[model samples]
Each structure stands twice: as structure tokens, then as C-alpha cells.
Target: MSGFGNGRDIISYVALGDSFTEGMNDPYAESTGTGQERYRGWADRLAEHLARTCGEVRYANLAVRGKLIREIVQRQVPRAVELAPDLVTLCAGGNDIIRPGGDPDATARIFEAAVRRLAATGSRIVVFTGMDTGFQPVMRHLRGKIATYNMHLRAVADEHGCDVVDLWSMRVLQDRRAWSGDRLHLSAEGHRRIALRVCELLDACPPADWRDPWPAEEPLPWRAARQDDLHWAREFLVPWIGRRLTGRSSGDGRTAKRPELERLEPARYRN
Candidate 1:
């Protein structure tokens, strides 16, 4: 396991979790060998960083959108263990915690269990806290649950000797621009910031600081605000609710985009 400032070489890395780790909503066009396109999320960004510093690195991403903590633990964790990567990042439970009747404590327990299993493989494990969502008008109700879950996550990481990317404490992510129009996943910019933070956390490379504040934006007119909300509800919220009701998932029938260990691509950071 590599520690911060240890200057160790990371030859193999794997990412496991849900939409956030899957790089959802941060769309990109890539040749996945089936004429398929995909998003290059923080995991890919970090892999690029590692490759830059270490010459070459092997990487894999097993994340899929809409997976709950249990699903990820059951399906992805074992695969990650089989890979036995030198580095692994796990971020799950967000989809479960945001549900209407979800239990933060119960979810955290399962999350801790997943972490323990991954830690047992002796890979350097990195976990993340959900960003504070209190500022989002529609998602404000989830703030308490996120906070509680974060507490458990921190305690659990400490117990298992894992590194953490504490997104809950990141004030910059509270900005409205950091999120996508769905108010669920991060925007492209948000994913970039997360990649930079992960690089800083791992001491892989000195990328731009993730703490920089976003420039101010003029407030939208009352009419515009109403229209935006209506659009969001119709386009995103309603479908999410329908899926929940039907016991369906956004990740249903979806497989990992980058499932095997491969050489990292060049840095694609765009300032």
C-alpha cells in the first residue's frame, strides 16, 4: 500500500462503485472497440496522472451507474479482489442513501463491510464522502443522511487503514455549477476537480488545486428559476422516481466500460 509522499510506483489500479465512479453525465466519445462512447471520469483522469509520473500504468474501471452499496459489494468487490490491483478506489451507497426510505446507518454498515473486504487484499484503498447537498433546493432533504453516512465512512476508513477523499468538507463543491442539470451527478468540471483532488491525495502529480472557488454567476430571474425546476423535474426526477417504483436501475444490463487492466491514456486535462 502506498502512502501520501511515499513516492511509490503504482503499476495497477482499479475503480469500483456507481455512477459517480462510472463517470456518468461527464460524457466523452471513445472507441470502446464496439463503436461505443463513454465518459472519462475521475478514475480515468487519475490514471492519466499516474501514468504521467510513472511512465506507464495499468488501469481498470468496474463502476456502473445506479448501483447500490450491496450490489457493488456483491458484484464488483470480488472482481476487484481477483484483479489484486496495487491501488483501488471504492465509492458506493449514494444511490441507496438517496432513496425515499433508505437507511444511512444500515447502508454505512454494508459500505464498511465492502471496504473491509477490499482492504484485506492489501491494495491501497481510497474512499470518498458524499458532498454536502444542503444547498441544492430539491436535494436539501438528503443533507442529514449524507452527514450521518459521512461520519460512519470516516470512522470506517480509519479502522481499516484506508485513505479518504473527504468531499463532504469540500466547500467548492457546494457551488451550483459543480453539479449537472439533474442535480444528481457531477458536471464535467466537477469530475475534473475530483481528479485533481485524488492526484493530490495520492501524491501522484501536482495538478491544479481543487479548492479554487468558482467565479460568481448572476442569479437567474424568478421566471427562469421556475422553468429550470420544471424542466429538471420532467426530464430527470420523474424518470428516477419511476425506476425506483419499478425496482429498475439505471445500470441494469450495463457492464463496466473498462473492465480489464490496460495502459493509461495521455492526460486530457483541458483548462
Candidate 2:
């Protein structure tokens, strides 16, 4: 458990999900571009745990904010296949359920296709999580659709022999303190809780051998925080307009245009 990553010379993880996985408004978002991760969301926190306790693991977040299952299959999932990650985490089907005038069954079909494609990889350890939608709005109709889609995800995990983390069922989601203003994304502590849970599970059924607790001098030392990694949400990871963007409106009429990033203090950039 302590020297887990050291066991594998190289370990990689790719995250595929909607906004929550992308870490829409998490106060502690890592600056992937020029900023520091600072143990922000689940992706960064999980990476840090592997680095500090287990050893080191290369991680990527291909999750988009407003991405539907169809978009993920077309855009993100392919690159994940190309990366051939040791572990892949899929947190999808949320947006598809809430899209403007969406068709839930169609989105589920796309999700099934994506999971099937990933299953073909025969990955040793694949993990998936359900969407988080437990809040005041309750989002009656969309929540129902999400339940249906998560059911499919469970089926995919069973068929492919992968692990599915029922994130929606986590206590953090059930607790009001863990969510932000909109009651959608997780707070800093919330994200940390998620990372801990995932780590516990990985440690339990670890795919590769644990890294050496005491290894010789490492090739690349973990670098200090970079200023470039600290920027306003838009500037942090925002690709060129021509590149690609998440956090798009799903047209569900529930998509708010206000900057939830406002909740995140720009002063953290003072760090």
C-alpha cells in the first residue's frame, strides 16, 4: 500500500465523465495548464495519493463539463483507448440525462457502446462512477433517467468484469455540507473524501503490485507548485476556442450561465 506505484515503473489513469468529473467549480481545482493541482478535485487528489503513498501514477482528465455520452464516445473515449491506461474511470450519463430535450435511451445506447469499446481493451482494472444528482431540485425526470443509465453502467461493469464505484450513493453526496452553492459539484473536503474512497478501493483490489516503499533515487522528483497552474477557471485549462470546451449548455433549461467559478476565490492565485 505504501510503495504501490513503485511496483509499476509506469502507471496511468484516464478519467472520463461529465462536469463533476471535470471538476466544474471545485474551489481546489488543480491548474493543469500553468497552475498547481494543490489537491483540488478527485482527479488531482487521487493522483497525489498514488504519488505520495503508493509511488507515482500518470493521470489524465478528459472529462468535459457538458459532454453527453455521444460526445464522450466521439471525442474523449478514443484517446483513452489510445493511452491504454492501467486504470480508467468513467463518470458519465449525467449530462445526457439533463440535456435540453434529451433522449435518455439514445444516450444510454452511446454509453453502452463506449463501455463495450473500453471492455475490448481487456484492462486489468477499470472503474466507473455514477452521476451525482441528489439535491434540492431533486430533478425529478432527469434523476430518473440517470438511475436508468447508472443501471446500465452496472451491467457493463458486470459484463466486463470492471469495478463500478457508486459515487452517487456516497455519504458526501447525501450530506448537504459536501456540495457547493448549486448543490451540484463537491466541495474541497468532498473531493478529498472521494479520492480517499477510490484509493481505498484501489488499494483493496490493486491491479499491479505495490511500489517499493524505499526505492533508490527517483528519476524525476515531484516538482513544486507552478504559478502557471494558478489561473481563473476560464484561463486555467481553457483550450483555444478552436480546440474544445466543456461546461457547454446542455439546453436542459437548467444549465445556468452564471460563473460558478465566482465561488472559487481568484485570490488563491496569490499563492
Candidate 3:
């Protein structure tokens, strides 16, 4: 049993995405995973929630800020497969529209590839967040791109049997107050809303059971997404707050061994 002591086997979940998934600039995790810094973002909340259900679980935020779809397919996806996680959640594709310019075709292809690889794991459950509603809501072009990417992502997820959070659709009702000053990154409340939805999604559809370990596959190129740290939040609030909140200091103590992502490999598309 884990120190939390719910007396259940620990389930492992691997997150693959951009800054959002990594909890950047979210002012959430004051304690980093390795205990070097604070990781006061949605991932920590998700982990704390997992502890209550599964009791003890390992959740890896393999997401690098500013990550593009191609880099994810080649690197993060591969690493996630290596971990053989029970469930995988993705909150990527936004950077593909904003950073280094948007490449719709390339973004879609790589995102599709990443999903394919993750699905190959067979018994794994995948939760996907769309590519919209971040950055420069004024930039009609980027906003349009986000819409397009989300549509494409939906088709692919449906084809592969993956569940989606539809954050773009869910948060459309909230205004600038929910958005950070940059007009792109999410405000503290926005992130908490997203995190709560994730918990619901996970609980609504549990991961499928697996009998044997997943087989390994060829590695793809990995590109580390670049992102501005959005973790500096003056306000910290967990809405409808869960009963089992990981004590900030205690959780910090547990993450002492985590490693910060320094760099990611660049990758090109397959077609």
C-alpha cells in the first residue's frame, strides 16, 4: 500500500503534450515532480485524485512546453509506450498553431501518428484535449487554425476509440477573466476547470484491462516543444476541491526524484 494507504495497486498514467499538459505558468505546483521546484498545476491535482481511487499511482508529465505534433509522435509517444502506462492523456496541438507558425497538414499527421502509437498499446485508455482556445483569441488566423485542428483531432480520435475533453467547446462560455494576460495561456480557474473535467473523464471511462505487457515499437524522432513558463500564479484555488488533496509539502517530498526536461529531439513527418 502507498503512504496514502488506500490499499490499492498503483496505476500508472503518462501524459504527452505541450506546456498545458506540463502545467507551465499555471502557478499550481509549488513543488516540482523531482521536488526541485513546485508543480502547482492540474497534473498534481490529477495525481492526488488518482491516489484516492487507485490509492497509489505514478503519473508522468512527459509534456514539454511549445511541443509540436511531430516531435510528440517521435519522442514523447515512444517514451510513453516504453512506460506501458494504464492510461494516457494528451493536451497538445495548441503550439502547432501558434509557435514557429502553424502547419495544419503537418500538425494533423503527427498528432494522428502519436495517437496511433499510443493506441497500439491495445489495453490503454486515452483522453485527448483539443487544439483550440489558446493564445491571441484576437488572431483570427490562429483561432481558425485551432478550430480546424480540433476537428481533425476528433475524426482521428473517433477512428481510434479515444475519449476527448473538448476544452475549447467547454470553456467557450467563459470570457477573458478565465484567460491569462497573454490572451493565450489559461488562467488559474481555466486550468482547474480543465483538471476537473479530466478527473470526470477518467472516472467515467476506466482503462481497459490488460493481461500481458505491451510490445515495443520502433522509436520516432522527438522534438521538445518550447513554451513560456505560466506557473507563476498569484491565485491558487482547487474548485469543488477533492477530499484527498495532496499536502503541498508532503507531495513535494514525494516528487524529489523527478527529472526536469531539458531538451527534446527534433523530428520530421513520415509523409
TM-score of every candidate relative to the true structure: 0.93, 0.66, 0.65
lDDT of each: 0.86, 0.57, 0.56
User: Which window of ten consecutive residues has the lowest lDDT sum in model 3?
Assistant: 262-271
Candidate 1 lDDT by residue in tens digits, 108-207: 9999889888888989999999888878877789999999999999999999998999998888888878889998888888998999898888876656
TM-score of candidate 1 on Cα atoms, chains taken together: 0.93
Residue 49, model 3, lDDT: 56
Residue 70 shift from truth in candidate 2, angstroms: 1.4
TM-score of 2: 0.66
Provide backbone clash counts, one per model: 0, 15, 27
Report the poorest 10 consecutive residues by lDDT, candidate 2. 255-264
Error in Å for residue 7 of model 1? 6.7
Model 3 off-target regions past 4 Å?
1-8, 28-37, 99-101, 127-137, 204-271
- Cα distance off (Å), candidate 1, residue 264: 1.5
Q: Predictions ranked by lDDT, top down?
A: 1, 2, 3
The runs of at least 3 residues in candidate 1 whose Cα sits more than 4 Å from the true structure, single-residue gaps closed, are 1-10, 29-36, 267-271
Candidate 1 residue pairs in clash (backbone atoms < 3 Å): none
> What RMSD does model 2 have?
13.6
